[model samples]
Target: MIPTKLIPRTAEASEPPLLIKSLLAQSLKYEPQREIVYRDLFRMNYVEFNQRVRRLANVLAELGVKPGDTVAVLDWDSHRYLECFFGVTSAGAILHTVNVRLSPAQILYTMNHAEDKVVLIHEDFLPILTAIKDQLTTVDKFVVLSDKVYGETAPDVLSGIADYFSGEYEALLKEASSDYDFPDFDENTWATTFYTTGTTGNPKGVYFSHRQLFMHTMGLLTYIIGYEAMPFKGSTDVYMPITPMFHVHAWGFPFLATMMSAKQVYPGRYEPELLLKLLIKEGVTLSHCVPTILNMLVSSPAAQKFRDNLSRWKVLIGGSALTKGLAQAATDLGITVMSGYGMSETAPVMAVGYLNEQEQQLPKEDQLELRTRAGRISPFIEMRLMDDEGNFVPHDGHSLGEIVARGPWLTQGYYNDPERGAELWKGGWLHTGDVASISPDYWVMIADRTKDVIKTGGEWVSSLDMENILSQVEGVAESAVIGLPDARWGERPHALIVQKPGYNLTAEAIKSGLKDQVERGELHKWYVPDRILFVPEIPKTSVGKIDKKRIRSEMKEQILTS
Candidate 1:
């Protein structure tokens, strides 16, 4: 009775709904021998990778991980985490990647809130678990993942506790059967859950369905490289994820890399030296990280020593804007850098700064400027610039508005908090809480985060704009701008600067440079900060973005004392 054209019902037509497992199976066929390296210690081909993942699913079953059970992970980015992405989810259990950087109380809250039944923890975080084990209510078992063999020197904190200690990760896989019967489930089933660290209060959990995760991976694959002259070359690219796996699925690269069957390198911990060595040794061509990580890498002595090796590396910078000064510095070090944008919501990635045909043909400097924008939305995503009154704003490249989006891969709502969830999805669009200007050509240039914008005399000033200008000041290493309360103007901007070694930077010099730019019409005069503070370092959040909330509190006390 169905139309012939609509027949996914044919016997030959699998008609299977979208799911994440299909990505894993299809990628192995492309490059089965592609290697996945873990630190400087371990390496495995795609075939071996599949076997290990299957073994993990089998072992998880033996540990009594049931459907709907949350299997939490507390580890650095490694091959093991990649396996957990698939094996746990493929086994029909939700994968809860615990943010190890969270405080003991915060970590306990997320684990308890997610109601995680099993935790696959790295040896490093054993002390953290030991401290909070008494308070953990939902965690039934703890599986240790160690680089070295356990039981030889297995700390009592890990192996001695019989009630909570389940087994070692590798040992369980080796002892379990390899034949994993991954059954078909509704594609809308919950696959992964992770918490978002807002400026204050307890973290809120955001979850994604299997279909959403699968579609996000596909969207990245299609838009990033499916078009011509893109950076990554499918199976030929060497990928290393610098972003923590716990943060936004490492911005969804592990899945995309697995789907491409590309050579992957997972740095267990992010040490600047270790990362530089890996890039040179493994020939890592493509990676994604925040501005802080890239700045750390290019500013390192190792980068200067291995400048030639860095030339071949292409990095996508997100988590914050890619300032022109930072991009130029990376270029000088021979690293190709571009800005990308996303959040913990929207399955993490909705836009990347890729060049179109016309934009690509422009001058290199102009191209760099164009490419630093949070480019057009991902394919199949519906984006709009909404004004304060909820009307769509014009895309004339000057009018700024909040960037809202809707798509298949976007998270339906915040997990367990209907009130906040409703706010997130208000007006049928996922509120990004980021203000941006869109050009008629479809470029989305982010101006500022709604909360981070500085209000002076009731006029808006971008903290990022101040930071960008400060970044260009001679002898300035990094800069962060925050809005401080002022009785006269309501709020004035404050600048925090970290100086480069061997260079003496004074507040007057910075102010003078900013004044020159303002006179040249390059920047608005109101964008200038009221005060400049030279600090040894800026405080950062768990994922390495500037901790404005903490800095604001601490700096206020310092100002009062001074």
Candidate 2:
């Protein structure tokens, strides 16, 4: 039997499990006249919002979508994408969100892997989809979600065996049933599937069940209110999900925004300047984004304009490590910045670095430092770090090991790949394959990926430590460390550097930074990178993590051609 404690009956629980359905009901019940605003469109209230979601679901069914059928959406963050996220999942269909940033082949591969029955595509991506239509196998229909209505094509642009409809999403929803008796969906039913953009291999698809999502939604609700001894969420809080919905439900902000009745905004396409403008104009109280994105935004010339706006903004950083420099900048600007960590497979929120009971009384600077570290394990999660021998590592924040986790919201396996699924679920635990150290306080600090860990002269070196230290150097914009092939030591550390604009970086300076580490005994003399190569910029994966694979590929090409 499922623990009642696991699924608490809060005031939010009185509503239906059809999350969109409940959201619609809430808007009508508490604030019938309150605005549910989007870019260029305002959903007047729950009444109008519910009707549209219902119609969209009906239109999807009319276009041949069935329960369990995957309906892929490819678009920037927008109200249309948000509507479809709820409408598709509400209809007992799996919402497969494609990362539009991926190349044509990668996008096609993900769609085919999901066996998407219909593609509710953005009009902007039509040309690209048209180009690859010949290769897609399972797509039976194409419903082009447009802000404006358009007529049928005079000429055949796509050679796919499917009908196309270019319909205004809002109008189509007017034609759908406002009161949909949603199918009694089993909690174990698949709700969504997405591919993880792992730096090493082809993206692996991970899916979530309805029950898992329900639990995730609850966890998000708990997180927003700081239920696990976090900063209390206020009703006046304004939310801007700079993170796209395609990225783990925008880290569950969309659901929480509606549940908490906060003003919700989506940056149609993330531009740092535009984001700052919105933050200033909209008086956004909270936002979530990666450290890199924040770094770029705060460094922009226009950032000065939002100086006072920054004071009211509370930000959460994820995707990659949140460095002390970036955190200090945000803190100095009065931005309440905290680091959070999760993988795509874990519904993307295993832990948030909010103050607990003991942390609450600490001085501001002390609290800020704690906020930078991955906080204690969340209520719903159980985490452990283990070595290859299955021995548990000490939580003294010094010993590094692999992070493995299991929880209600954690994914069980990849969509169809059994071999990888077994590896991911080895020992009945979802292995993160990320090397990290946990403190006695239960704070988790990721050192580097297990595959990226460097070995030199029979000793291990942390690539993340080297990269972090390198980033502190003047004239260095970004840096990456990787284990390169070496005859004597099996693998040696290699450095890839992106110099600041108008600056020239030398290998000598990077070696100098490590020379101190060598003297201090933090690193051995031979563990330093033998060569440093400067690049135009660091390549990033779809979700914005540094793509070391691309660096290795370019280096290999340069070597072979030379």
Candidate 3:
């Protein structure tokens, strides 16, 4: 450690700080001519992209945005949101990526909580804004982002809020000069913030600094480029992000793609047919999304229509675990599917299930094993599991413990909430709250969230493990397993399974299949759920992970009473 007396020296000559703007600047230098495509409606090369970014910055400055001011945006994964990522932050203001999927009450809370001074709304989301219009206290200006899929004309839907609207995104940029000096600031200043998907109560805020996001971008690139076998190709690959742009900056792909000058396609308000069309038409090679979105794509008629185009695509599944059944379906379609693990608290890319050279040589059937685990932890993240008593959980491939991580890119804490923040950063590690184990070779496999583990007769069983197995049942479309109260055993599992159309899977048939797997030693007798219910659909959170909390509350008495 250095001497304390020398630590506070602003006079230090060699302190080279990292900046987020550097990512854009570096991209502009080399691939300024690379294409940035927006759903066939808008297209621009990096040189023009830079001009748009600067113009957006000038517009914000004209609207009285200053350093440290919070500018919030409510839009889909579009080119405009991409501009805000750089322009707002480059101008030294904080970008609040508001989750438009939240209830109107939640949206009102988040905007006011962030004290957002300016709001950028997509024309589609205008009604949502007006519905909560009077409740918005901190928003001073609203810039409407056009939602025209294939036209230059703005939507006429803003008449309801004409008094609330400030200007249109295109017109404002057109009026502003493309020359504004974005002053450099300490990279530790806040850059972006968004609320967690929030299963429990009110949504909590998570934030990242410029340095943190830049470091995350570097960490992500380190593995994506370093691991040549990563599902998504680098630089030359066509990139699309099915994850909402407001969700962890679409897991930071926009920044990484911009930095690489990769061809980017933004499919606004993702429709299965439209996304499939763009996937083939634009030759999109890589994208990331939750499993539900992928399930939607593969289940659509568009998938069959564009079957030949599926082989060229690669997808990273996160926000929830990827089921083996889903992996098999993707494999059959010739789409490369892999699992990734992280939370909203992480700059959200911690690990990706990528095979190494040796592992890649294995048969395709065996490779799916590697493709389904939480995956190898990415570069620069220190991860390990700890037991219930806070002792080290040995990496023996069987011991389970809560997954915790420490990294340069991990959030410092929940923004402005010190109590939860301290708990999150407890024991000097950013507690991931996910339970997982590591193989001897260091491949990480997340079993379940800490709270979701099932305990029966003093034995811990993974709820995720059961759901993963049940998902493979022929007629099952999706599954959710929850440990319910049992007087005989502490808690036994109850499962809710959604069936595919034209298939009626009875509870006995499902149990019989599970029993066969148990006999084959693939599952434990206790691991078999005590009860299974076929449902039309399983409830899901906003970002499309299973909503067990809601299910447990809704079905507990019925299951117990039965």
Q: Please, what are the lDDT tens digits per residue for candidate 1 over residues 243-298?
A: 99999999998898898898999999899999999999999999999889988988
Better of 1 and 2 by TM-score: 1
The regions of model 3 sitting more than 4 angstroms off are 2-16, 149-153, 157-160, 229-235, 560-562
For model 3 the local lDDT of residue 8 reads 59
Which pairs of residues collide in candidate 1? none
The best candidate in terms of lDDT: 1
Off by over 4 Å in 1: 1-14, 150-160, 228-230
TM-score of each: 0.96, 0.88, 0.96
What is the TM-score of candidate 2? 0.88
RMSD of each: 2.5, 4.4, 2.2
Who is ahead in lDDT, 1 or 2? Answer: 1
lDDT of 2 by residue, 1-562 (tens): 6756556567755443444445434545565444455554344554566667777888887787888899999887876777776788878899998988889998999999999988877667888788788789988777665544434433232333244554545555767677676666566878888887775567899898777876777776776575733343535677788787888878866765665555667667778777887777666788888877887877677777668668878888888877666676677677888888898989888878867777789998788667777655666888999999888888788998899998989988887788899999999889998899988777888888888788777777888777766766777767777777778888777788877667876788778878988999987686578778888777787788777777767765765586
Clashing pairs in 3: none
Candidate 3 clashes: the total is 0
Show model 2 residue runs off by greater than 4 Å.
Answer: 1-24, 32-34, 40-44, 147-163, 199-202, 228-234, 357-368, 501-505, 516-528, 556-562
